[model samples]
Target: MFPLERQQKIMDLLKLKKVLKISELTEELNISVDTLRRDLNTLTKQEKIEKIYGGVKLVESKFAESSMDERMVSHLEEKERIALKCTEFIQDGDCIYLDSGSTTYQIAKYIKHFKNLTVVTNSIPVVNELMNSSVELVIIGGKIRLNEQSVVAYDYIFNFDQLNILKAFLCASGITVEKGISDYNLEEAITRKKIIDMSKEIYVAADSTKFGKDVTVSIASLDKIDVLVTDANLNKNMIQKFRKTNTKLIIAEGP
Candidate 1:
């Protein structure tokens, strides 16, 4: 088999079995030990898998997420700075979509004063925060995912294509040059993909820590987003890497 084909086969097998010994992988693929090592190194560099002492495991399955309350406090200062920077993109009358996330939730506290602005979301926390705010609020009603505190429509009651979404501020579990954007939940990623397609512009609000990671469900690639707003704590190496991509980068500075 070709190198790319063999590598893909390795990933497929790992996804199914979760982890396997190096000897097991070599036997399954009918490849030499040196070739297997080369493939494993490539996957590791892509942040798709990790090498244990004698075995390898899929990275996506190992990534754990905390509850909404825990995440809110985990990156409090960085999230706040990102939230403040996102507000600059909002105009007086633009309609926007805020994807459910702790970082995106911080935006709710700052956007109350904009006139004729409409905020559409699936997040319960966002709705409650802007309940009495002057800006028009629209909720995407569906089955509630309590842990994330967000609603997801499995039946398409709300046609996002019909809505004139000027901008969409989204969050994701992981973002990478090769994988683009991804999430842990398949349902959530599906909903975000719909919003991304319908909106005029896409703005992904992720902290520096979220970079270089890849999750199970694919959202959109780097080219799909108009801008990526991240904190300045992101290293110069990563920033330089993104500079080579088509996506525009915005680094939020600390006050």
Candidate 2:
């Protein structure tokens, strides 16, 4: 594999396993020990990982946020399924808010049929997707977050307050029964919080993998979310936990 691809695989493995030995990485990548060592050294210098005695571990920090590219490739089918389900709640001429997230970005694909929908979003990808569509696109302009390709600024909070959003669709880095909805970036979380307050109804589009995981910042409580849209792979135990909350769950079955 190429060096960049090898490094991305190493990072993905580290995210899944937390820590991995050099031998394991060598076996997985089918590369020479010397080459893997060089790759690890480069990653270490970039502060993405730390070398231990015989292995490397991810730099576990509260501020560690995954890039848009990584998230886009992680759960492609599940996100698409959930996005399709989201269309059921949308109608022609409705004003809605779409957060800067991978799943929410997918919603743009299924919303093309809406003739007079007004979409307010902070995601650059979502903006590009609907720019030429019949829907009126409103971008939350502010400081651009390069990794996630979203905008966040304190001034934009007031802009959200001025609009009457019928529904706001969001995605989270993690979701738990207690901590509610959370994300890795504080600025994005703040932006989401503002949108949540402005909208009359709230919907969270999250994959099953996000359940039970608590990340750095909490956006809102479960009670604030009117509906939860996820893939059908969600287990019964998780469904029961969500049942205890005020948020109604919608399982998106595949085609």
**On residues 1-255, what C-alpha lDDT tens digit does candidate 1 reach at each position?**
988998899999977777678899999999999999999999999998877547777763356764675566556788889999999999999999999998999999999999999999999999999999898999987889998999996655776666899999999889999889999898899889989988999999998989998988999999999999999999899999999999999999998
For each candidate in turn, the TM-score is 0.75, 0.76
In model 2, the runs with Cα more than 4 Å from the true position are 1-63, 156-158
Top model by TM-score, which number?
2
- Give the poorly placed runs of model 1, Cα more than 4 Å off: 1-62
Report the poorest 10 consecutive residues by lDDT, candidate 1: 60-69
User: Which residue pairs in candidate 1 have backbone atoms (N, alpha carbon, C) closer than 3 angstroms, thus clashing?
Assistant: none
TM-score of 2: 0.76
Report per-prediction Cα RMSD to one decimal.
Answer: 12.1, 7.6
